[model samples]
Target: MSEDTNATDDRLRLLIERIERLEEEKKGIADDIRDVYMEAKAVGYDPKIMRQIVRLRKMKPDDRSEQDMLLDTYKNALGMA
Candidate 1:
C-alpha cells in the first residue's frame, strides 16, 4: 500500500480501538450502576422508582414538567388520575 493508504489504515484502526475500549468501559459502568440498584433493593429501596428518578433528574426541568403535564393530562383523560 502507498504511505498515504497506510496512514489512513492506521488512523482507522486507532479509531476502532478507541471505540472498542469506550464500549467496554460503558459496559462496566452499566454493570456498576446495576449493582448499586441491587444494593438499594436489598436495603428496601425501590429500584424501579429510583431509576425513574434518575432519568427525570437527567432531563431539563422544563422538559420534565412538560412531560409531567402531558402524563397527567393523559391519565385524567382516561379517568385514571
Candidate 2:
C-alpha cells in the first residue's frame, strides 16, 4: 500500500511539472505572436484590426459571419463603403 501511494505521488508530481512546462511554453508563444504584431504595426499595419481579424478567425464560423456582417454594416454607416 505504501509503494502504491508513493507511485501515485510520483505520477502526480510528473503531471504537474508537465503542465507547468506547457504553460510556460504557451506564454512564450503568446509573447512571440505579440512581437510579430508589433512588427506589423511598425510597418504601418493596423495592429488592432489585425488582432481582431485573427481573433475572429479563431471563433466559430457562425460567430465570425455575424461579426463580419456587423463590421460591414458599421463601415457602411460611417460612409467608408
Candidate 3:
C-alpha cells in the first residue's frame, strides 16, 4: 500500500481502539452506578426515585423548573392535581 494509505489505516485503527476502550470504561461506570443504586435500595431508598433525582440534578435549574411547571399545568388540566 502507498505510505498515505498506510497512514490512514493506522489512524483508523487507533481511532477504533480508542472508541472501544472508552466504551468499556463507560460500561464499568454504568455498573458502578447500578451497584450504588442497589445499595440505596438495600438501605430502603427507592432506586427509581434516586435515578430521577440524578437525572433532574443533571438538568439546568431553569429547565427543571420549567418542566415541573409544565407537569403541574398538565396535571391541573387533567383535573388530577
Candidate 4:
C-alpha cells in the first residue's frame, strides 16, 4: 500500500483501539456503581429511589423544581393527591 494509505490505516486502528479501551473502562465503572447500589440495598436503602435521587441531584434546581411541580399537578389531576 502507499505510505499515505498505511498512515491512514494506522490512525484508524489507533482510534478504534482507544475506543475499545474506553468501552471496557466504562463497563468496569458501571459494575462498580452496581456494586455500590447493591450495598445500599443491603443496608435497607431502596436502589430505585436512590437512582432517582442521583438523577435529580444531577439536574439544575430550577429544572428539578419544574419537574416536581409538573408531577404534583399530574398526580392532583388523577386524584392521587
Rank the models by lDDT, top first: 4, 1, 3, 2
Q: Which regions of candidate 4 are displaced past 4 Å?
A: none
lDDT, model 2, position 33: 96
Best by TM-score: 4
| True-vs-predicted CA distance for residue 42, candidate 1, Å | 0.6
Q: Residue 24 of candidate 1: its Cα lDDT? A: 100
How well is each residue in 1-81 modelled by candidate 2, as lDDT tens digits? 699999999999999999999999999999999999999999999999998889877999998889889999999999998
Q: Least accurate stretch of 10 residues (summed lDDT) in model 4?
A: 48-57
lDDT of 4 by residue, 1-81 (tens): 999999999999999999999999999999999999999999999999999999999999999999999999999999999
Once superposed on the true structure, which residue ranges of model 1 sit more than 4 Å away at CA? none
- TM for every model, in the order presented, reads 0.95, 0.75, 0.96, 0.97
* Local distance difference test scores for all models: 0.99, 0.95, 0.98, 0.99
Tell me the number of clashing residue pairs for each predicted model: 0, 0, 0, 0
Best by lDDT: 4
Candidate 3 least-lDDT 10 residues: 46-55
lDDT of 4 at 11: 100
